[model samples]
Target chain A: MTKPLLTVEGLVKRYGEHTVLNGLDLTVREGEVVVIVGPSGCGKSTLLRCINALEPIQSGAVRLEVAPISRESRDLPALRQKVGMVFQSYELFPHLTVLDNVTLAPRKAQKRPRAEAEREALALLERVGLADRARDYPRQLSGGQKQRVAIVRALVMHPQVLLFDEVTAALDPEMVREVLDVLLDLARQGRTMLIVTIEMNFARAVADRVIFLDGGTIVEEAPPEEFFDHPKTPRAQKFLNTFTFDAVKRPHPSSLADPTT
Target chain B: MSIAVLRDYLPLFARSALLTVRLGALGILLAVLVGVLCSAAQYFRLPVLQQLSAVYIELSRNTPLLVQLFFLYYGLPKLGIRTDPAVCGVAGLAFLGGSYMAEAFRSGLEAVDRVQLESALSLGLTNAQAMGSVILPQALSISMPALVANVIFLLKETSVFSAVSLMDLMFTAKDLIGLHYNTVESLTLLVVFYLLILLPISILGSLVERRLRYAGSGT
Candidate 1:
């Protein structure tokens, strides 16, 4: 019954002859955690990028809170202010300190005073237990720490929705847990999030709905339990089967909630 | 080889040194300004400027510095465009150095992960703000060693100012040689003067290079 916070309608994106996203449509209500998983090169990352307006769609529309998101119709920076995206390769500004990195957008885009920006940034860093590392540079931190700092950077803007484009893909196996814990905490805090990840367990634990995409279209969508335990589509079954029996497995992504509760 | 030669020429050398420093500083500054515009134009594919930048970079980079100097200093006068010799010489160096500077800048900008721009945009920074605040700084750090090397090259090449009749260090040395016929001594003194001016800059360049080594490569 609540208003949808985000909507993607008949979205189509292409790179020359190849179509990366094809006539995709979805809607998310406020505070829903939607996880997208598919085989490599299946347009999962492109879909998230299109939502953020980083990749311009060839047709269709993306809207946030009843407003159309288009290059011609909107002030992009202002639109971006409402939707924050964290990249797969933690693109932290290497030249600035971590504190500066967190505060740059607030100071520049929102024109917040320095002390106010730093104060807010410090609190967010403290939330992630990175307050002590505020003075360190991006190069000084590990992959997990850099991604965590990146998450805090996005949070400082108080965006309406957060997008993660495979944020844990670059991490060491040991480091993935630290970053996922942050995501789990954000989900528990009731934030609206769209995550593109291969961590089957994390999706199974936190996703309000799991979307299995193949060849640029959603093959199946359901609650995680139903989707994982009983994938209805042949494409979904095949995709999961490939990962189901690999010997060199990624460390298992721990569970988020105890279903019995 | 006596103390008198050193003492007598010190003031003149000081003045010539000042002149060289002033011209070198101005030329390098102009080169950097020209480089920023040219490389940005190329990156954005700005209509006419991009083509102009490409032609200018290639022409300047390929031609000998001496010919460019002669063309600007001498050829322009006959075309009813007389300009100051110092202006012509500085413009020439800037043109030549800027071409190389643009290459350095282009590479540096490319060295950055393209994802950086997307992230910056998502943070609500406008394209200009993203390029200026986030992208340009990393590019600068990566491009610095090449830029500094270009500057050192410019300082040495400013010796060509003598042919243009500009009062650069090499010009002053030529005049001293003409007056005293102490060719070896005067040239040796000029070399010392150049070393004194440029060695410190070389040291600073290396220091900066060391600091920036690991900064731009982080994820």
Candidate 2:
């Protein structure tokens, strides 16, 4: 088989004396949807940052198209252009209008004409149902709207791989669905994605593979259907139990016990 | 308030006020330059530049503006580097005002969401591009009020240039007052002279603060 579109090999990251990602590895095939679910401190966010070279790695490598992305690598900038990332906080450039924010990467780094970049940005905005808000600043958008715009911002780069780091964790309950629909649409279009998220239902529906990470390493990896139905490890089982079954869907996971019982 | 008495003094007041405006403008320009350069050095953490910027900020901030002026005007001459009084005065205000501006900018830059940088990097922007496009604009707006107030402080501080015999506001007024022995006229006119210069700048500063107001999270 051809190499995965992106690969993490024995990645290690540390903050001072505490290691956050320890000898962890992952591979994302082209057009594949991978979801990473973990407790808060399990190094999910650090993994994404290290992939984009946003955080320094203590050891190992993050490779894109078989080229290593490291601090000293001359191709880091060019590699960055190929792997787009959407931040957890919906970190849109607040001063720019939604159109400018979406077009900034293409216009500046890609050296595309501003007018051309903006025209493409407007179409992406339209796809995300934010076409009318092209002129509005990030401050004016709701959390969901901002996240969609951030997704559009990343997509406009036409990257080979997309990384989502808890993309919907900060949104209101009502707002979360809209952002998930956008991600789902991205997946349907065959975009390669590595998502760190807590929205279990969205992950259940959208992920090709679900990864359970604990204690700085992936404890279990399986297709979402298999992982959700038959969690392999105690950590995975305990985490799934913590979900309140609050989402309105096929009768709550354990709520509809057999009438015979 | 005789028209003819005012007419006779108008040209002198105007010349001195013009001198004051030039010094204020030049001093502010230099302060902005120093603030951007030094604060960026601190932001990037360049070794020798950061250390020099720290020393410059500390030494200029701790010393009084008047003392800095004397040191530039008198002390420097001892080492055979003589500068004109006007040069000394403008340079002194910039030197002093720059330290405060740097502090204002450092805090402003810090207040910008760190996540913005992370997002920018992930999008393929170089560090400099990210800072110029995302960070500095927000920082300037956030730091505007402090920057303006410090500039106003420098404008007022220019009055101290009279001690260095720069022929600025106070020096010009002192000369005319002593020449005329008309304390009431000279002092009253002096007050108006300072106001005429300061009021417009203060108003402009407020307008800028209002214009660049971050409409994002009020935090």
Candidate 3:
């Protein structure tokens, strides 16, 4: 088995007498896509936020592979540069043009030159299908376009791991698929991703593994086939039952997969 | 009524106007410097400096400017500190204006979003660098209108210097009225003189406010 690119051990988070994440543990192998799903306030977002030190945990350890030196310990800003995040709200700098937003951290943080940074920024924007929107401010973009720009903004840092906190949650239904398509493309490109998403269908299609959380605990986790088909725990069965009727009635593309081949 | 009277006193008026302009400029410069430094000290959570700045701001802001001026000009001498009337007047205005300017800057700094600061930190900029590069530019743009308005107020407040025998615009007007027994005309000329100086400052302040608004909206 390959070495895990990222690891979390006994992660615990609380908010003034309320436990949000209760000793959760997980790992992601290099180039793996792991999806986390849960109801609101279930700590999926908190879990992702902790990996990048956006929210410090009470007691846990997150280790990332920093290149060149390959240090195991977490230096948060360095870790953050390696582990990029895409917020649900897009969170683009409203005052900056799209190009500047993408280039800002690279230039200021990484000390990259203007021409080189712009070159990388333009490429990332093009990859997200937003090269033409470079000079435009975020407010000028649609919900889908803004989210895509946000993805590109993170990607421009060349991060080793990407965390998505329901990147499509704020978008309109029609706009959801566009942003998800970008994520699927990134997944196909072999980027390690930890995604907190409500779209179970997308999770079933793309995730190598799925973890379900309830009341700040991991209720179940397994490969997509086993997790969805033969969930062992009662909470997992009940959770899967919510989507089982629709999964049967609708023509899910997974049913068409060549099981024999 | 007499052209000779006008001709005779025109140089003195000009000299006094020069003095008034110098006092206003120096006082405002010092006020802004003190205000920015004190506000920054408060912002960075400096231990003793923050408390001292807060106390200074409160005392200066709450007390009457006249009393503060009297304290500087009259009381300081009793404490064996003898400074020129011009120096005392400028010091008084600077102290008073610094309090108001500090409040203006504090509000401007507060107006910035917390997320912007967080993003700056995430980008590897130090706290001070983030403030200077990302936060302060935006805050200054936000605070420019208030600062400009304060300048006009400071300019007008320079009138208080006349009470300390600084021979500023109002002082000269009083002297001319006392010598010529033309109280009504002298007071009217003083009012016109002030209007001449303050009207331009008011217009300039509005222009700066408009520019900042446009930049904020345009961005």
Q: Which candidate has the top score in DockQ?
A: 1
Query: Candidates' TM-scores?
Result: 0.92, 0.93, 0.84
Highest-TM-score candidate: 2
TM-score: the better of candidates 2 and 3: 2
True contacts kept of 1: 0.84
Ranking the candidates on TM-score from highest down gives 2, 1, 3
Write down the DockQ of candidate 1: 0.70
DockQ of 3: 0.22
Superior candidate under DockQ, 2 versus 3: 2
Candidate 1, B3-83: lDDT as tens digits: 678778878877888888888889888998899889999888899999999999999999988899999988998999988
Better of 1 and 2 by DockQ: 1
Give DockQ for candidates 1 onward, in order: 0.70, 0.60, 0.22
RMSD of each: 5.8, 3.6, 6.4
Interface RMSD of 1: 1.6
The lDDT values for all models are 0.89, 0.89, 0.81
True lDDT of residue B178, candidate 1: 98
Q: Any residue pairs clashing in model 1, and if so which? A: none
Ranking 1 against 3 by lDDT, winner: 1
lDDT of 1 by residue, A1-261 (tens): 667999999999999999988899989889999999999999999998888788778999999988888776558799889898999888998889999999999999999999999999999999888999999989999999999999999999999999999999999999999999999999999999999999999999989999988888888999999999999998898888887667566655554344553
**Comparing 1 and 3 by TM-score, which wins?**
1
